[model samples]
Target: MSAYGFEIVQTLIVDTEPDEYVKRAMSKINAAESNYLAGLVVGLRDSVLAFSMNVPGTTSKDFLGMVLVTQYFVTMKEIGALSESNPVFITHGPGTVKDIASQIRDGLLQVNTTQN
Candidate 1:
């Protein structure tokens, strides 16, 4: 039988620290949303990477990659204030707010970057 199409995947930093890592993840997601960043939940294994706003073909995809990395850095800088019981955190869904945060921290962090 002929071989099937190979799945090409984008690589991301799989964080597994605990609590702190969670904050970092949420912070990035939050910053992305705050910046009015546009993109779908491409993947949610470790660290998240939202697609960039521009649609410049492959270049645009690369930009989305940049956004993901940049957001991670931004979050790391402010991880000190992140806590584990932030009310803003969500409690359901695959990429639910809480899951995203804690997943990075290896199921320790529990904060939500969303406001409201």
Candidate 2:
């Protein structure tokens, strides 16, 4: 299997209201010009949403990885009602990208299971 550098695996949209956590994260994203791709995830109390962007090649892989992970934590923290459990972020090879949707669904299911 060919190794893809940095690519967005999938995106998740949760319809909800904007909350403090979302607000804070958005504020940070807006306040700065990030070298790495950011702002894909919007935290809302009632509508938390996220979309993955594929960053090709290994050039910015390290930087992008850090930014993405940070965003994940920041956004997931204040999911409010949806905060029943922690959110999951999945990254896989190109071979598995075709099944990314299913992979995301399964990851969500796993999160739900862990919550209970």
Candidate 3:
């Protein structure tokens, strides 16, 4: 992973209340095309975290990040289902797009050193 490079495996747009719109969105993303290591955007009432979990067929090849949108909380079970990578959680204010660009930059640097 280079300093300016990051990969996005999967993306989940969740809602805290799990309403019709949120549910529909989740279903669509889940059914849509995704990468081997999926990234998740978990939303709470006041904050959101861009996260990735460890699942099957994924290894510590590199680190990446993404910005999560929407408003809703996610269950532990749901989080577990989609992630199979090192969990990266960064929380920020609601409705604000906190870019995980820096996180990915730092994380990859760390991974490179540790793996090497």
Name the candidate that leads on lDDT.
Answer: 2
Query: Order of all candidates by lDDT, from best down to worst?
Result: 2, 1, 3
Q: List the candidate 3 regions with Cα displacement exceeding 4 Å.
A: 1-99
* Each prediction's RMSD to truth: 23.7, 22.5, 22.0
Over the stretch 46-77, how does candidate 3's per-residue lDDT look in tens digits? 12222224344333332222222322134333
lDDT of 2 at 88: 55
Better of 2 and 3 by TM-score: 2
Per-model TM values vs. the true structure: 0.22, 0.22, 0.20
Off by over 4 Å in 1: 1-58, 81-116
lDDT of candidate 1 over 1-116, digit per residue (tens): 12676664755758666698888999999998966633333343122323332333446435544554555556554563677634443244434433444465553233343331
The better-scoring model by lDDT among 1 and 2 is: 2
Between candidates 1 and 3, name the one with more favorable lDDT: 1
Clashes of 1: 2
Best prediction by TM-score: 1
Q: After TM-score superposition, what is the CA distance of residue 17 in candidate 2 from its true location, in Å?
A: 31
Q: State model 2's lDDT.
A: 0.53
